[model samples]
Target: MNTIKRNRKNRLSKLAVVALCTAMLAACGSNTTATTSTDSTAAATNTSQTTAASVQTASLDLSNSKVEYDEDDAYSDWNASEATTIKLNGTTATVEGTGAETKDGSVSITAAGTYVVSGKLDDGQIVVNVADEGVVRLILNGAEIHYSTSSPIYVEEAGKLILSLPEGTNNVVSDGTAYELADASTDEPNAAIFSKDDMTINGTGKLTVEGNYNNGIASKDKLKITGGTFEIHAADDAVMGRDLVAVKDGLFVIDAKGHGIKTTNDTEGEEGLIALEGGTYSIESGEDALHSTGGLLVSGGDLHIAAGDDAIHSEIALLISGGMVDITQSNEGLEAGSITIAGGEVHVVSSDDGVNAASGSSDTDGAAGEMPQEGAAPADMPPADMPPADMPQDGTAPADMGQGGGPRGGGMPGGEGSSNNLLTITGGYLSVDAQGDGLDANGGIAMSGGTVVVNGPTMNGNGSLDYDSTFEMTGGVLIAAGSSGMVQAVSDSSTQAGILMTYPQTQQAGTLIHLEDEAGNAIVTFAPSKDYQAVYISSPDMKKDTAYSLYSGGTSNGTETNGLYDGGNYSGGTKVVSFTAASTITWVNESGVTEASSGFGGRGRGGDRQVESTQS
Candidate 1:
């Protein structure tokens, strides 16, 4: 008796009955019914016809078409509590079922076939543990399913599985979080909802995978997110895969306390690859926001990340061919085996170096650029100060550093042998605001085009001449403080000036002083007269406690004379000078050489003035 009941249960669960009353009500009219006997026969025939029309064996939808259910359609029923087992062969088909079952759960299919599941009811997690190796399509028709004990749906050893939901379905809940499977057993580490060998999610439904204590969705092979909204908050990683996790398109929001998305592969050439073609991704993570042991390429997407350590760290190359990436981090913004941003909008705010590629001791690998020699600086062009010909910066010069003018790379701090990392900025709007060296490259910096901005102390020393790095600006606008400026630069117009001074405690009745530019361009070379001889001369480059003598001869305002002589006394005829040193100097309105005396109308003219006047 028990065996018979079990068989009956299985058959009923598979062969579902369509409630004909609902279908007839949908086709109801205001016409009066015929005689009772005829009306009853017509109703029965109508029910049979409706059931036959709805039931069918079809293929899956390979084109990936879909329809949405809004608030107005929320009352409409599109679910099945039971369905007959039908083997799917193609990539397109739709399956309908009644959503009236209480305890037996939904239909169970073990065949290898591709199917699209849709409805408008709330069941528990729809389980699909397939035996054959074929694509299994699971579409939830605006229904909420709660996985109390087992996972909502389980797909085992399937060649491919596609999980989708209605486009307009909203507020679907899974233990306060939507869409995830969890097994509390301590031994099974890789346990979560939707454990499939391989799968694809293409639709408009939003799924929240929140199992921070364990994995969100464990896949033995690969998982690609072509579309949909995935909000994952996990303790380990949001998207976990034993092989590869490719994000071609979707709205992925991962707030992982650990790594945002990770893929670990033990194979040789089949390392995990995370390539982003189009979508929106926002990740906040403790370690690396987006990391893979293999290669990570962001060809096109909008990625905003806030990471505790490094925003993007990968073992291999991280190529940013196209994308809009905004990262705010504490440690480094991007660290990989090699980092190349040929095209993109990359804005990084980091405490350390904005973009760093610290090479590890794995094996002999050819980097994108020449490896920076030991005891040298980073090998990369500093941020270009010159604005790109395509896109210019917002502000103007001095204030904005203008376009194409970025911090020049002098050399990395410490020594050359520290770390041999290379950075190449062939194109893009690169903005880096760092607390450490603005642009420190061990190898070299090459500037072709684009805009790079670096604002900080170049070198660590006095404010005047203590630049930390040496810069070479081959092209582009180069703006740097202290030593961050480009090197050996010769422009069409250049201006340099300094102050000069000398003291004269007493002169031998005649003395002179000359002030000349460093290239012997004498701008101010003057000799004080007898009455004004005992004054002082000042220079801008004078150091404290250093002694200097006044030298003057044969010329004053283009006049030649001898009494203007005497390279003599300390305080007699001239030289009482004082000056200050600073990083930047601005002369408000500088005029030609003008001399003024501290003494009021010869007040300090002592013995000579008195005696000479009386004798005359």
Candidate 2:
């Protein structure tokens, strides 16, 4: 009798009732009536049909092909009351139901049901090989599984699988240093927990995964994580999904030799995706911290990462709507083909480039560029007050100059194809301290609203702002400080005004540089991370034909500058000089070398002035 009931349960669970209802509703019309029935019977049948049709239609529409998960569609029917309990001890396994089969050192689940698994498996495995349309839920209640030659848990065949870590439980899954599959035709599992179908992990417990072979957790299809506390240490990626990886809420700490979180599917129309709605992540990786081949969208999170390569990389578009990201160490802070920041709080400290928008995806093997040797700067860096060896001192292009009258490799290189890559900043608060270019784009840059502060490279090989095409700034506040070798201003299409000024001598780090209006109101105050000799300021508050003063060693008093109290307010300071509105100003060696002074839409060139010598 029990066997008959178990078989019946399996058969009932395998029926595709939702799909059948959808097909039936599509084959019939809403106004159809049974003509041979009585009036009451006809009315009752019509009402039933209408109700069933509406439900099926709603179900089909709700399960769209979006990367994000819908709770009602995927997790509404899970019930823990009817579940199979399995206990394991060493190489011995016991199942309390007829849905699971136990062999020598492996337990295979062949039916769809909720399962409660506990106990420690020293050298065994739990394999889920259900029917083609099965949905299984495995609840870990103080379970620990370790396999010496393969993955601890492998999902071979299933429509959807959910791994639940119940409250107050501590679960662990680990792999060994080597693996050998029994059947050569089976797909090899390279992670501690591997799944071939859609998988979801959620619970209130703590889970630890140690991947001695490859990845920590890998899903071939969509993978979603709603809740948990995870600590993962892996040889490869800590968490990887081939199709899509969506995280709603979690607390994760990852230590990886490869990428921390990654997606690598590159199908033409079905590439991989990564979406983060809410989480708290602290990652230390030898490669990129977060990477995707298709697209990456970050709406909310708190990310603190230290990476050997780029911190955040995307082959396609990368969008950041809201997050608090702090990248303390990276070669490139944020890199993408197309980058957009609508709202966020980002701070980056980089060795090569702070924010780079380029064309192609980076190599995932951490071998793109040669890393700089420890305690040594990059090659070809010019000293202060000097130009590159090949550059002419008269501001004239050399015979081997590249396009745009700049030196070779000074601007964007030619013949890189027509790149549609762009950096669009709508709203954000960004700060960058870089040893290379602060903000570089191979294509155009459009800034409508934002606040940017860049302490760019002290060397002459890079610039504070570098762009290939037009740079249109319709709104925002920008303060750029660096060496004055390859400086460019916002185009004439900008509505706000900009001033480019070069100081006579190099200002040491921690020196406050302040700008004030005629009424002694603070306008801009900045302290460069490195020594600087030039500054470019632009904002909507800058008016035409107004006199502004520059000061050094200043202490501020009134309103703050961009919510920063670095240089204090700008009320009282040691007055250096004052100048009227100008298109360009070159103050060199304590002597004013004034060039063409147009209001805001002009260009000029001047040489450095000489200081007078005093006899002691």
Q: Which is the leading candidate under lDDT?
A: 2
TM-scores for candidates 1 onward, in order? 0.50, 0.78
Please estimate how well model 1 matches the true structure, expressed as its whole-model Cα lDDT.
Answer: 0.40
In angstroms, give how far residue 276 of model 1 lies from its true place.
1.0
Residue-wise C-alpha lDDT for candidate 2, range 387-493, written one tens digit per residue: 45664443332344421122312122222311344566667788888776688765545666778888866765566776554456656778878765555555444
Candidate 1 ranges with C-alpha deviation above 4 Å: 1-108, 114-125, 148-151, 171-196, 266-268, 361-420, 437-447, 456-616
Q: Model 1, 135: alpha-carbon shift in Å?
A: 0.4
Worst 10 residues of 1 by lDDT: 1-10
> What are the per-model C-alpha RMSD values against the true structure?
28.2, 15.3
Query: Whole-model lDDT, candidate 2?
Result: 0.64
Per residue, candidate 1 scores C-alpha lDDT tens digits across 219-308 of 666666667787877656677665556566678888887778776663434455555667898999887788766556576789999987
lDDT of 1 at 231: 80
Off by over 4 Å in 2: 1-67, 72-81, 182-187, 361-381, 385-418, 557-563, 566-568, 582-616
